[model samples]
Target: MLRWLKERLAQQNEAVATAVAAADLVDKRYAAGLATYLQVLSTQNATLVEKRQLVDLQSRALSLQANLSRALGGGYRPEMTMTANAHSTVADKS
Candidate 1:
């Protein structure tokens, strides 16, 4: 899961960079061509949302991995888990 998140984050970074470049182009075009400010803003927002989603997904994947590690009696994995509390609630507490 970590590997997958790293790969996906790399891809998203590239995509975000491209989107920023495209937005720059759109900005320049707006001054001299048919491209409008609204168009550029819309694309920027979409890419921003995509980047945010990538981050959120990575967070969840790490959480699940951490929970699995603890449940399997391994080390804490040095990361946090969203399911840790829920799982503990169902099981007996020492």
Candidate 2:
């Protein structure tokens, strides 16, 4: 289940990136008068929705990971998870 959630999160991240790019394009088009303000607003809304989904998936994945670690009888420390999460976030930003 954790692996599946990770996979879904990765896909959702891609979806969010695509939605953001689309929103940016729509904004530019609207500025040039080639697209309606409504179009720009719609794209921006879609991007926000995608971003929300990504955040949800990330939250679920972290919860599941923590539960798994706890179930494993202290084999994994909470601090270790925090460190790993920080590294992953940095890697993702890059």
Candidate 3:
């Protein structure tokens, strides 16, 4: 869970960086050669909307990680562990 949260943070940073760069380009071109303010409004709206989802996912992942971290050494790890039983029929007879 911690690893998944870390990966989510990295991905969210990348996405926000991309939005920042796009906003910068839109900033430079808004006045002279580009279209009206609608483009800026649309881009900003989209960036904000995308960020809302990323923020929600990030919050959930971080909260889960923190809860798991707090559960360490409390004898509750097994309660959250995920195991696969898909290969149980093909056991090795040692």
Candidate 4:
């Protein structure tokens, strides 16, 4: 799942870069009078929206990684789960 999230984040980052480049092209075209100002503004707005979405995805990915780390006890160890179970069983007896 962590690997999947990392891959997804990478894809989103690429999308953000593509949107930024597209917006830059729109700006250049508008300056040359080949595209309307409204068109440029629309492309820029799309870029902003994509950037915001990318940020959200990044945040979720980080959160998921953190949760996974916590779940695995920072890093999985062969004896960690058994140790935890033993501790819980001992505590319940009291």
Top candidate by lDDT:
2
lDDT of each: 0.77, 0.88, 0.71, 0.85
Q: Residue-wise lDDT of candidate 4 within 1-94, one digit each (tens)?
A: 4677779878888988999999999889988989998999899899999899888988897777678779876885445769988999999999
Please give the range of 10 consecutive residues that has the lowest summed lDDT in model 3: 81-90
For candidate 2, give the lDDT of residue 33. Answer: 91
Error of 4 at 19 (Å): 0.7
Q: What would the per-residue lDDT of candidate 3 be over residues 1-94, giving only the tens digit for each residue?
A: 5677678778887887788778767877896667568878877876887688688987897678567667674434534443323244345332
lDDT of 1 by residue, 32-79 (tens): 877988998887897788778777877887788788788878776444
TM-score ranking from best to worst?
2, 4, 3, 1
| Residue-level lDDT for 53 in candidate 1 | 76
- Runs in model 2 deviating more than 4 A are 75-94
- After superposition, candidate 3 runs with Cα above 4 Å error: 69-94
- Order of quality (lDDT): 2, 4, 1, 3
lDDT of 2 at 34: 100
Question: lDDT, candidate 3, residue 32?
Answer: 66
Note the clash tally of each candidate: 0, 0, 0, 0
Which residue pairs collide, candidate 3? Answer: none
